[model samples]
Target: MVQKVVIIGAGPAGLLLAHYLLRRCNYNIDIYERRRDPRLTDISSDRTFPISLQKRGRKAIQAIAGLEEAIAAQSVFCEGTILYGKKGKLRQIPRQNPVLTIDRNRLVSILLKHLNETSSPNQVKVHFNCECTAVDGTAKTVTLHPKEGDSFTADYDLLVGADGARSQVREYLAHNAGFTCSQNYVPDAYKSVFLSRLNPSAGVELEPNKIHVYNLNNQARMLMVPQPGDQLHGVIIFGAENNPLEGLSTKEEVHTFCQEKFPIFGQLMSLEEAEALLKRPVARVLTVRCDRFHEGDSMLLIGDAAHAVSPSIGQGCNSSLEDVLILGQLLEQYGDDWDQVLPKFSEQRVPDAHALRELSDYTFPRQKFLVVEFFLRTMVKRLFHRWFPDWVKPFVFDLVLDTDLPYSQVLSLSQGWINKVKRSST
Candidate 1:
C-alpha cells in the first residue's frame, strides 16, 4: 500500500520534511501554506529584517539536497558576536562556524527551487495560498481553504504539523484528541528597520562576516545584520508590559524614544528618518510550548508549533530545522509503524523541548532592566569570560542555541559536575 503524509506550513521544517520523506520513503506528500507563493512576488514587505540561520539550520538544508553552495552564495558568514557589557565594555566571542546571515526571502527561494526540482513534477504538490482551516487527527484528514474560494479535504497516513506558533493542528489535537498543551507569550517586543547607505558606492560600513549586537544593558537592545552590499538590517527589542509601542504614536514620540534609549541608532541611522519609517507598531516576541507534542497514532507537531523559543538566544530557526532532521531520522527508523513511531518521537523530543522552553524564558530577564541584578550578572559574565576557555562560551551558547541534546541528561551531568566542584572548593 502507498502511504501518504500531509505536512502543514511550507517553512523550512515542512518543506525539508517533504523532500526527505520523498527521497527515502515513497510517501505521497502535499504541503499546505497559508501565504501566497513567495517566489512569484515580494511578500515580505511587512516582515521584519531577514532571520539568521545558524550552523545547525545550514546542516539541515544540506541534508535535503546539496544546497550548501547555493545557500552560501547569498549568506554572509558571521565571524563572531560583539557583546556589550553594562559599563560599555565590548567583548568578541569567536567561533569556528560563526552563524551565517541570509535574507529570509532568498533562503526560501532556494528551498522552493529545491522543492520544485526534487518533488514529483506531476504528482507531488505544494498548495500555495491554501490555509489549513481544520485538521482531524483521529480521522487523519486535513481541510484546506484554497484562495479560489473553495474547500478541499485530503486523507493522510500521517500528519506533520509545522504550522508555527498559533497552530491549528495543535489546537485540534488538544481539543479533539485529548492531548495536553500549553503556550506562553513572553513580554518582549521587537521592531526591524533597514539602514541603507546614501551612496551606493559608499561601501559597507562593517565587516560582512559578523553578527553585530549593541547591547544597551537593559536600556534598549539593538542588533544589526549586514546584507549583500552596503545595506544593513537592524532590529530593536524592548520590554513592553502593555505593548511598549502603543503610546509612541507619532514620529516625534518614536524619535524621542530612540534618541533617549538607543544611542547606537544615531550612529547607523538618522533619528528623524528612522522615526518616520517606523511610525508603525512594533512586533511582539512570543514563546510557545506544549507539554505533549503528539496525539495517538496520527498527529505530531514540530518547530514553533510544538516549541517556539524566544529569539534572545537566536535558536528559534536552528531548533525548528533540527526538529525536522530529528523527526525525519525517527520516521526512517520506525518506517510504516505509525503506531509506535508517533509516541516515541514525542517522548524523545519532549525533554529537549522543555529545556529550550525554560531557557527561552530565562533569557527574557537578561534583556529586562533591574539595577542590582544587572550588576551581579555583569560580574558573573566577566568572571566566566576571564577564566573559561574560548571554547566554553559557545558551549554555554549551545545550551540555548542547540536543542537536540537531551535537556534533562545535559542538566543532570552539569549539576553533578557542579556539585563535585563545590565540594572541592569547601
Candidate 2:
C-alpha cells in the first residue's frame, strides 16, 4: 500500500521533502502552503530575503540529481564578503568555497517547479493559499483551510510539519503530544531591500560575486547579496524596538536616511526602491527551540518548524534543508519504518539543533571590543589552519560555512569562544 504523506507548509523544507519522498515510490505526497504561489506573485521582495547556501545545504541539494543545477542556474555565487565600515573603509574576507545565493522565493519556486515537472500528480500534489488548521493524530487526519474554500480533512499515514517558525502543526504537537517548544523573537527586525548592483554613471558597482555588508551604526545594518540581472536583493536589519527609520515617513526621507547611513549602497539605490522600502512590512526574526522534533511515529517536524535560529550566521535555511537530508537517511536505515525513523531522528538531530541555537546566538560578538577580537581571532585561525592543517582547527565560522562537518562537533570545538561571547553579553 502506498503511504499517504501530508506535509504542511510548502516552503523549501516541505517541497524538498516531497522530492525526497517521491523518490521512495511508496509515498504519495501532498504539500499545503498558507501563502499564494510564488510563481504567480511578485511580492517576494516584501517577505523573502536572499539565502546563501553553504556546503551542508548545497550538498543536500546536490544529492538529488539536477536539483542543484536548476537552483544554481538562477543563483549567484559569492567567493567572499566585502565589509564596509565608516568612510568606505573596506575589508575583504575571501573564502575558498563559494556560497550559492538566491532569493528565498526564487529558491522555493525552483523547487516547486522541479517537483511539478518531474513528479506525477499521483505522486505529489501541492496546494498553495491553504494552511493546516488542526491535526488529529488519533484519527490519522489533518484539517486544512484554504483561502477561498471550506475547510477539509485529509487522511494521512504520516504528517510532516515544515511550516516555518510559527508552525500550526508544532502548536498541535505541543498541546496534544507533550512536545516542549519555545519561541522568542530576536531583537532584530528587517525589511526587504532592493538595489541595482551597479551605478554606472558614478563608476560605482558592488562586486557581483561578493556579499556586501554595511553597518549603519551599532543598531542597524544592510546586508545585500548579488542576484542575477544586475540586481541586489537583501534586507535592512535593525533593532525591532529601535527602528532606524523612525523619523522617515516618505520615500525621500527614507532615501536620505540610507544615504547618510550606508552611503555606498545608498549611491546605488533608486527612488523607486526607496518607495518600496517605505511600503514594505518590517518582519521580526523569531527563533524557535524544541526539546525534540517528533511526537509519535505518525507526526514529525522538520526545518524551521523544528529549529529556527537568528540569521546572523546564515545557517537557518541550510540547517532546515539538512533536516530532510537526515530524515531521508533515517528512512533508508530503518527500512522505511517510520516508527523507527521518528525517534532516531530526534535523538540524532535534537542535540545539534540545541547546539545551533548557542552558536547562532553568540557566534558573532556584538560589543565593539569583542568585535575587534573576533576578527583578529578569525584572521589568526585562517593563517594557522593553512600552515598547520592537522594541528590547528579552523574557526567556527569557517567550520560552519566552508565544511560539512557535523554541527555538534563544530559546537564542541568552538564552545570556549561561544561561552566567552555569552558571558560578555550578559
Candidate 3:
C-alpha cells in the first residue's frame, strides 16, 4: 500500500524530503509551494540570499546520490571569511574545511530538478503558486488556494509542513492539536544586495573564494558571499530600531551612503543596484520555536516551520537540512512506519532545536567589548585545541562549521560562553 504524502512548500527541505521518500518507494508525494516556480523566474530579480552549507547540511545533500556534485557545480567553495573594519582594517578567519555557498533559490532548483528527474509524475508532483490555507488533521485533508483557481482540498495519508516559519499547517496544529509554539521577530532586518565581485577600473576586487563581511557598526553590517559569474550576493543587515538606510530618499543618496560607509563595496555597486536597493523592501526574520515537531502520527513539521532561528551563526539552512537527514534515519530505523517515526523524531530533535536557538542567539555577542573578546577567545581556542586536542575543543563557530557534532552536545560544551554572552545581552 503506497501512502500518499502531502508536503507543503517546495523549498529545499520539502523537495529534499520528496527525494528521500521517493527512494523508499512506499509513498507517493505532492509538494505545493506558495511562490512561483523558481526555475522559470529571473535570478536577478530574486530577493533571496546565499546560504553557506557546512558538514551537517552537506552530509544531508550527500545522502542523495549525485545531488551534492550537481549543487557544487553551481556553488562557490569559500575558504574563509574576511571581516572589514574601519579604515580598511581587516581580520581573517580561515576554516579547516571549505564551505559550499550557493544561492537559496539555486539550491532549491537543484533539489527540485533532481526530484523531478528521478521520480515520475505518478510518484511525485509539485504544484507552484499554491498556498496552503488550512489543515484538517482528523480527516487528513489540506485546503489550498491556487493563484489562478478556486480553493480546493486534498487528502493525504501523511502531511508534512515544510512551509517555512509562517506555515499554515503548524498554525493549524497550534490551534487544533495542542501544540505549543512561540514566535518572535529578531531585532534585525535586512535587504538583499548584489554586486560584481571585481571592480577592475578601481583596482578593487574581493577575494573570489572568501566570504566578505563589512561592519559599519553594531547597528549595521554586510556579509557577502561570492557566486558563480563573478557575482557577489548577500544582505545589508541592520537593527530594526536603527535602520541606516532609512534616511536615504534617492538612488544617488543611497549610492553616496554606501560609498561613504562601505567604500569597497560602494566601488562595486552600480547606480542601478543602488536604485534597486532603495526600492527593495526591508525583510525581517521571524524565529519560531515549538515544543514538538509532530502533532500526530500523520502530521509533522520540519525546517523553518519547526525551529526557525536567527541566521547569526549561519545554521538556519544547515539545521533545516539536518532535520531531513535525521528524519530519514528515523524512518529507516522504524521501517518507514510514521507512527513510530514521528514521536521519536520530536523527542530526539526538540532539545537540539532549543539548544541551537541558544547557540544561534548568543554565540556572537552584540556588544563591542564582547565582540573583541569573542574573536580573541575564538583564536585562542583554535590554537590551543591544536596542541591539546582532548582538553580544548574549537570555539563554537569552528565546532559548528567544522564538525557534525549534535547541536545539543555543542551547546553543552559551550554553555559558559553562551551564558556570558546572554548576560551581556541583558
Candidate 4:
C-alpha cells in the first residue's frame, strides 16, 4: 500500500520538503495552511508580519525549484550590513560572500507555483484558512477547523508538523504521545514601522544593497531592511518587562517615551507618526525549543515547531530550510526503513538544533546591548577575511549563521584554530 504523508503548514519547510519528497517518494502528500490562498489575490493581505528571505533561503529555494536562473531573477542581492554607530560613525561591513534578499511574498508565491505545477496538483493540495486544532499521534490522525465550517479529520502514514511556535501539533505530541518540550518567551518586544518613499523617484530611504542598523545598547536596537519598491521596513526591539512605555495611559506619555528611548527615531518622524504606532500594542518575540524533535514513528516536527529561535540572528528561517534539506537527504538515503531513518534524522540534526539555539540566545542579548565584544568580534572577523580565503569566512559564518554544523566537530575545529591564534597573540 502507498503511504499517505500529511504535512501541516504551507510555510518554507513544509513546501520545500513536499517538493523533494514528491519527486523522490511516491507518497500521497497533502498540505494544510492557516492562511487564505495567496494566489487568489495579488496583494498579500494575510501576511501581517513580514519575513526577510536571505541567501541561505535563496539557496534552499534554488535547490527545490531546480533552476538558479529563475530564482535569481526574483532576488535583491545584498552585500552585507551598513552599521550606524555612536558618534555618527557609519561603517560598511561586507560579508566575504554576499547574500541576496527576496521579498517574502514573492518567495512564497514562487514555492507555491512550483508545487502547483507538478504531478497531481491535489496530491500536495493546500487547505487554506484551515487551522490544525489537534492531532492524535497514536491514531495517526489530525483535526483541523476551517473558517467557515466544522472540524475535520485526516489520517496519514506520517505527520510532519511545521505549524510554528505554540504549535498544536507539538502540544498534541507532548500531551498524548509522551514527547518532551520546552518553550522560552524572551523578554524582548518589537514594533515594525514602515518608512515610505518620500517620492516615487526618490527610491528607497536606505541603500537597497544592505540592511541598515542603529544598535543603541540594551535600551533599544533599530533595524531597517529594504522591501520591494521604495519602502523600507524598520523594526525596533526593547525589553518588554522594563519598558517605560508599557503603562503609558495617554498619548502624551507615549510621545515622551518614544523621544526618550529613540531620540534619533523621534527626530526622523513627525510626532503624529510616532504616536500612531505607540497607540497600537507592542508585539512580543518568543523562542521555543523542544528537547526531542520526534517520538516513535507516527509524528515529527521541524521549523519553528521543533525549534523557534529569536529572529535577532536571522537564522530561524535558514535553519528551518536546512532541517528540511537534511531530513529529505536522510529519508532518501534510508528509503522504506522508517525505523532506522527516523532515529538517525533526530540524531544528525540534534547537534545543529542545539547550535542554532545557542546562536539565537547569543545574538539577542549581545545585539540588544550593542556589546563591545560584538564590535571587537566584527573587527576581528573583518581582519580574518583579509588574511584568509572564502573557506575561512564560511567556517566562522557557518557557526554564526548556519547552525547545521555538528556541535562537537565545530568545537574541536574552532578550538584547534583558536589555539593557533593564542600562540600568535603571545
Highest lDDT: which candidate? 3
Q: What is candidate 3's lDDT per residue for 208-296, written digit by digit as tens? A: 99999999866799989999999999999999989899998999999999999998799999999999999999999999999999976
Q: Give the TM-score of candidate 3.
A: 0.98
* TM-score rank order: 3, 2, 4, 1
The superposed Cα distance between candidate 1 and the true structure at residue 333, in angstroms, equals: 1.8
Write down the TM-score of every candidate: 0.82, 0.98, 0.98, 0.82
RMSD after CA superposition, every candidate: 5.3, 1.1, 1.0, 4.9
**Which model, 1 or 4, shows the larger TM-score?**
4
Weakest ten-residue segment in model 4 by summed lDDT = 196-205
- Pairs of colliding residues, candidate 4: none
The segments of candidate 2 whose C-alpha lies over 4 angstroms from its true place after superposition are: 43-46
How many pairs of residues collide in each model? 0, 0, 0, 0
Cα lDDT, model 3, residue 145: 97
Instruction: Decide which is better by lDDT, 1 or 4.
Output: 1
C-alpha lDDT values of all predictions: 0.68, 0.91, 0.93, 0.67
Residue by residue across 1-426, what tens digits does model 1's lDDT show? 667778888876787777777776567888889987778875335454667776567667778656767778777777776665544566676554466787666676777787787666543688889999998666678999998987989998878898888888988877887777877666667777666523234332555566667665454577777777666676777776634456666767766666565544434566555664567457776667677787777787988888887776676777788777777778779875778877888888888877766554443333233324434544454467558846333233444343345555544534433343334434
- List candidate 4 segments past 4 Å from native: 39-56, 66-72, 85-87, 103-106, 197-205, 242-281, 363-370, 385-398, 402-404, 407-426
